[model samples]
Structures are given as C-alpha cells and as structure tokens.
Target chain A: MAVTKPITRFTLFGGVVVLLLCLSVFPSSGQAPKNKDLVHVEAYASHKRVNSGKSFHIIITANIKQGFHINSHKPLDEFLLPTVLRFNETKGIAFGSVCYPKPKQVLFPFSPNHLSVYDGKISIFAEGKVSRNISSGDINVSGIFTYQACNDQMCFMPESVGFDIPLKIVKAD
Target chain B: MVAVGGFLIGIILFAQVANHVHKIFDPLQIKNLVSVKQLFSAKIPEGVPVKLPDLIITTIEGEQLVLKELTSRNRLVVVNFWASWCSPCVEEMPHFEKINRDYQNKNVTFLGIATKDLLSVVRKFIVQKEITYKIAMDDQDKIANAFGGVKVLPTTIFIDNNNRIVKIHKGYLSQRELDENLKDLLH
Candidate 1:
C-alpha cells in the first residue's frame, strides 16, 4: 500500500509537468491579434534606374485587413490622427513631398463624427531625388509608416510599420 | 523531496486558476468598458450651460442669417455643424429632419451649417439627402469658430428659447441619445 501511494504521486506530478509544457508550446486561440497582422505594407520605386538630380516616385502600398480602415493623412477632424510616412535622409537620396490619396468618408459608430479613412488597399506616393553628385549604385531608402486603424465598433492602438524601398541611382551627365 | 513536490503542485494549480480566470473575461469587452465620452473628454470641452455665441452665416440662397436674431422667436434651436464629406453628418441628417418634423409645431427649429465645403457641394448634398431644414453655408468657418471651434464633425448644439446653449453633443448621435438630450427642448 505504501509503495502504491508513492507511485501515484509521482505519476500525477509527471502528468502536470507534461500538461504545462503542452500549454506553453501551443497558445490558445483567444489571444489578442498582434498589431503587425492587421496590415501588410510594401514599398517600391516607380523606376528602377534614374539619373542623379532627377525625381522618381516611391510608392508604399498598404493592404489593411478586412473590416479595418486607417485614417487618411488629412483626417479632416482634429480628434483623429492622420497617417504619416517619413523617410530617413540618406547621403545619396533625398525625399521630397509626400502625397496621399483622397480618403473615403466613413461614418463609424465608434467615432462621434465622420472620419476620412482608407480601407482595403491604398497607395501613398513620395518623390525621391537622387543627389546630383551620387555615383551609380543601388541605394536603399528606409522609412516609417504610422497609422491608426479602426473598425465600425472600435479602434486599435496606433502602430508604426517600417519599410525599405530599394532604388538604383545613375550618375548625372 | 516531499516539500519540493508540494511546492510544484501548488504553483501549477495557481497557474491553472489564473488561466481560467483570464479566459472568462473577454479582453475586447474589458477594453470597451471605457466610454467614448471619457476617451474624447481630453480634447472636447465639457458641455457647460452658457450663452450661444453670436454668429452669422450665408444660406445656400446667398442670404445672410444671424444666429442671435433667431433667439427672439421664442423657440428651441438646434444648430448642427457639418460638412458634405463627413459621413456621420450625412447619416444623422435624416434623424434630425425626423425630429424636426416631430416638433415642427413645438417652436423647435433645426439648422444645419455646412463648413469647409463648397456651396455647390453643399447644395448638391442637400438635394441628394432630401434635407428640408434651414441649411446655411459657413465658408469662412466664422460660425464654427464662434461656437468654440468645431473640432469634430457632426457637433450638435442645443439652444433653449433664451438662446442659452443647453447641451453640446459631439460625435455621431444615436436616436436614443438624441431624444434624451432633446427631452428638455421637446417638453
């Protein structure tokens, strides 16, 4: 009888350890969705090669998850935060005026008023100028994209998504 | 050895209880507990009872209408600041018109003031929306600035017969909330 009691206790402890390990390895489905999963961002250059001192459009396309919409650069309301894209200044590349597409007017229940929003897929364009003295090589331009996403019911916290667009620069004759 | 086994079992049991408790409370529900008023209160001024500011705006017909002049009519006036691009403003227009219809003989008037929109677009929107209330164009945003600046679209200001700003509502208003706020104006 004494031997049986010890064996049962040892088996119970082993079962608990195995259960904990399994739980840790496989997270439950009830967990909140990660911020990155809500939107997909891709940055690309309009032209692969451009002469130095010439300007080219760098386009950033954002694919927002279904049922979610992001605010436009000009939200038209003071309370709403606008989506902004800013590029880091590189030695060989200079970013110029950033242009945002016209946003659709969406009336959401969560917002007390109408909001200018972009949903599904939207493209933002920025003009990039290669330095007049730059050599012929591929230059990588990195930028940060910030936006606030919301649905009809509620809005998620603002998130910043980083992107890198590669461009080739040719020497200006 | 026995003490270590007991401690491990206690920790495992506690974790199980914690996990179950977390599952019972939906995180989204917890987040929704924060009211919209609390979220916007940081920027939206509180609705304090004060005299409505004197302002004038041009109607779509190019006639000037002064807000203070409407005070002597011995009626409740509902002033709504909106733009054609604002979706919430469009959605609430019919509701306002409906309420206006209900109290047409109660000495209550509903006025819609369009801001930041071209008169052509405002006229087009009014025709499309079938809005019959008094529509005014605030091209210069003068009327909006006088009423403490319209930071949000679809801001409705309720004025009593005395031209006192009784309630200032910010955001998209539901039928129930509109009715509740208009209780004073109605009866």
Candidate 2:
C-alpha cells in the first residue's frame, strides 16, 4: 500500500473517498482512533445497455452509516438542509425528474419536532432516455449527490459526492 | 358513503405518518434501552501557533465584532463553531456561556460563531436556551475555512495572547474539559 502524506485515501466502490482525519492534530504519542463514515453512495443504471429511443432508470443508492442520518430531499423542518441530486446532462442523453424515497422521522432529545431523515439504505431513481442519433458505444452520465449527515447529537459539514452511471447505447432494431 | 371512505383513508395516512415519527410514550421502556454516545475528539499537540487572520463577523442582532480587537493586548479568545441543527453543539453551549460569564473583564473573550445555520433558527435557539455570550454568523463558512475548515460540529479553537491559534478541540467537550483547558491558559 502506498502511503501518502497527511491524507489517507480509500477507494470506495469506484470513487476515491478522501477523509481528512484529525490524527495530524494529536501528539505523536497519541494513538489514532478510527472514525466512522457518515454516509456512502453508489449509483448504477437499470439497464447497462439500452436500445435507441429506449428509456431506463438510473439508480442512486445512499447507505447512511450506522448511528448517522441525513436529511431527506424534502425535510419537514425549514431550518434543515435538504438532500439533493443533480444530473449533469451529457450529449445524446435526456434526463428526467429524479425520485426520492420518503424519509423516516425520528424523535431525539435535541428537537421538539420529529426530524425527517434517511437512515440505512435509501435509493433515488432517475429516468433517462437515450437519443436515436447516438451510435452504439459507452456514454457516461455524471451526477452529484448533496447531503448533510448528522448523528444523534452532532452534525457534520454538508458534502457532495459525484458519481457517474455509464450506459451503452445500441441502435434500435 | 364516499365522504366516509375519504375520511377513513385520511386517518390511515395520518397514522402511517405518525408511525414514522417514533415517539416512545411509555417512560417505563427507557430502562430497557442503553444510551450510546460516540465522538471522535483528540488533544492538540504543541505546535507552532498559526497567525489567525482578523475578520469582521455580524451578529444576528445586527452587531459587528472584530477578531483583532478582541485579541488585542494579550487577551485570550475562544471561538466555538456551532449550529442550531447540531444537538451536541446545543448541549455544549451552556458550558461556553458559563465560561464566557466567568471570564468577563479578565482578558478573555468567548465568541460563538454560527455557520451553515439559519439566522431565525439561531435567534430562537439562543433565546430559548438563554445564551448571552456574543454570537455571530460566518457567511459561506469564510471563518470556518480560515480556521482550517471545521468539518465537525462544536469545534473549539483557542487563541492565546499573541493573536495565534494555540489549540483546537474537535467534538463534544464536557464542562470539566473546558475548565481544565481554561485553567491551563490562565496560569
């Protein structure tokens, strides 16, 4: 394993998850403790290859790490940051509206109202249609998932995870 | 008959929404549960104190506070980054308020900085919690990024008399820890 200065890089699925640890702040004698990840996201297309003019759903799944939760796309509270996903349109690909799963509400000691959040595995689906003009090849549909993850007591900074769903286009027979 | 059916469906939907909000009405069940609290915090080792830049921060009440003026004349400054949405930050706020009250006119100033939070929410929170210490907003996380990007909530930075950041504590710090850190800085 190649060791990099300061930053310890880990490859999650196909993306590089760069976690800036607080180890550098501690003394040399202090042992570094393992911190938990707030959330993990991965995405894939319903059909790896699709016929021209055919439609498919792009599935994006976010797994909230144990002991953490992220606000839903439509958080019930006005003060909360809503989780959002944006697909960067590529050539010959038409994107449709993305669907977000309903969030679970949990009552904690902090707030008087129940907080709408996503825990465990939650998937967001987006519809995409392939254009008839594209030739048979691989095309990358890039998107970014933005969320603010929080545990029972504290919340981490808002983060955006970028992903790509590659699809192969075949001419309609 | 149609009205009755619509009312029944509405009741069912309301029940489903209520079920999602897990509220334990039975206080007797609390004994069976174990409270688990986890935090990743560490002590900052002695290093070269970074020269912290002075900036202007506007409070929710439309007042401005300058970092350079607060740190002038060898005064110690405590800047705590917190948000109303963060429960741990709310829990740790009282300790800072206590310390802020204790350090009045003692060459120590405690300023609570809010980032990624709503002004109205913060205002309601302060009033509800009776927070009297000077508080301000760090727009676009400018102050947080300046202090090396506070990734976690309730991150506290201590600046000594020399206008340099001396220590940084991450995560929930208890009142005892706050007292200990202050004792070290004072003497």
Highest-scoring model, lDDT: 2
Candidate 1 chain A: 10-residue stretch with minimal lDDT: A26-35
Clashing pairs in 1: A112-B171, A112-B172
TM-score of 2: 0.61
lDDT of 1 by residue, A1-173 (tens): 98799899888777776766775686543233455778899999989889998988889999999987888999876545689999987887778899998899876674456678899999999988887888899888899999877555334446798888777888887
Candidate 2 on A107-152: residue-level lDDT in tens?
A: 8655556888899999999999999888899889898999988776
* TM-score for each predicted model, relative to the true structure: 0.51, 0.61
- Tens-digit lDDT string for candidate 1 (B1-187): 9989989877977688566444334342233234545333212242332566666767787767677777657467888987765556666778888888987887777889987677877877788779998899877767877776665567787776666665566666777767765774455
Which residue segments of model 2 deviate by more than 4 Å? A1-37, A132-136, B1-42, B45-76, B83-108, B116-149, B158-169, B172-187
| Clashing pairs in model 2, backbone N/Cα/C closer than 3 A | none
lDDT of 2 by residue, B46-148 (tens): 3322676777777777887777777885467899999876656877898898988887877788889997887877889889889998888876988887776
In order, the first chain's TM-score in every candidate is 0.77, 0.77
Interface RMSD of structure candidate 1 (Å): 10.7
